[model samples]
Target: MSYFCGSYPIIEKKALAGQIYSYTLLCPQIAENAHIGQFVQIKAEGYMLRRPISICQTDKEKGTLRLVFEVRGGGTDKISQLGAGDMMDIIAPLGHGFTLSDAPNGKVIVVGGGIGVPPMLDIAKKYGENCTAILGFRSFDRIILDKDYFATGARTVLCTDDGSVGIKGTLAAPLKEELKSGAAAVYACGPVPMLKAAAEEARLAGVPCEVSLEQRMGCGVGACVVCACTVIRDGKKQVLRVCKDGPVFKGDEVVF
Candidate 1:
């Protein structure tokens, strides 16, 4: 059975960062089966394709699912206006998430840039003290979820390009320091540049790393090929759909 088999009612909406909004939807079915790093497809009032959004946090006790997203285009703008009691079509818990077992007891580092931190937040929550969260935004006004990460008791690092919040630099420099200090594995989600830089740092440091890719989707299910991505295996390139194979993939396997 589909987790989001019917329309869900929106319970609340709040701004998390600069131009970023987080919506909490009330759907018992979805809230029950939702997992960390999974996403949902929401059908806009007049749009043809549904907008895919990651599941930020699921509150089973309250039967709510929170989704955080950026307002970069038209589809998201329409979503930002939704208020309490608004109804939406959501198909949830889609795509493969991070492989948590890959790190086990080692120091697991999570790196996020801009809107990418939404998916990794839950992962850090589950890992508890063993997790290290590195969050970066363009400026101070763009930061989100720092307190939550710190509250997890995980060692949290903050960075910004314009010196607005934490360290004033790219995530790579501190990440290199973490790896040198012995972070066993790293997982990241963010812009292509940030993912690439994280992968490079991991490679140089000999740390195992995985990355979650963000791509446009026509359908959250496996039906459409709109979210196609290329992966390199055995020195050959193969095509994979982000909606089906993964929004999360091993950093070394993906072909930029």
Candidate 2:
């Protein structure tokens, strides 16, 4: 993957949910090199460290990159205050992404929960009708990109924890049903618990699965060990850096 550190102009910025903000940036280099599940690190105002946000969408022709993030603390709160026309420093197109080479041959299940839902949008767009998206949120107000997923023409399923909207349950219910029918592959990103459950379901079904992990990152690059996670590689357990080795790994390979 190619990595670029530059000041990108914010083409547009808007609030999607209560504390969630979407920002579109004019970063040609990153836009051209970015893959579906790769992420970018933005330097938040007044914060010494950069915040890692996944790439939601990319327009190579237009040279634009889209990111959706939640305002969780002081760093993200500062990011939420920025508006259009502002320039933001970012290091992008980092880490590995999902594999889509075999998607056209058979049914592919794309699952995401809460903030993890955004990255799944580009996958749906690429795989088109072959992808089935299962998105889970805490409630109606936290729901995001429902229309975007529908626009991709991929079969979409939405789940809400409180039963305020869509199905009254977690993503695991629909995911289990999908696996039973048969799936060639599955891609998931969510909380640790949700990912573990999804991984186990896919494993039990004998289907190939990949998961994007979220971790506390100090440096956006591999210089720091903050994002390390235990993974079984070549039958040996090792601590891998999420920023470099992956944010994405084979479902069966992850120790969690």
Against the reference, the lDDT scores of all candidates come to 0.84, 0.91
Off by over 4 Å in 2: none
| Per-residue lDDT of 72 in model 2 | 95
Would you give me the overall lDDT of model 2? 0.91
Write the residue-wise lDDT of candidate 1 on 146-254 in tens digits.
8878888888899999997889988999899888877767899999999999998998888888998888788778787889899996788989889878888888999
Each prediction's TM-score against the native? 0.93, 0.98
Least well predicted 10-residue stretch by lDDT in candidate 2: 98-107
Per-residue lDDT, model 1, residue 19, is 83
Pairs with backbone N, CA or C atoms under 3 Å apart (clashes), candidate 2: none
Candidate 2 residues 105-222, lDDT tens each? 5888999999999988998898778889999999999999999999999999999999999898888889999999898889999898889989999999999999999899998688
Which candidate's lDDT is highest?
A: 2
Tell me the lDDT of model 1 at 87.
Answer: 83
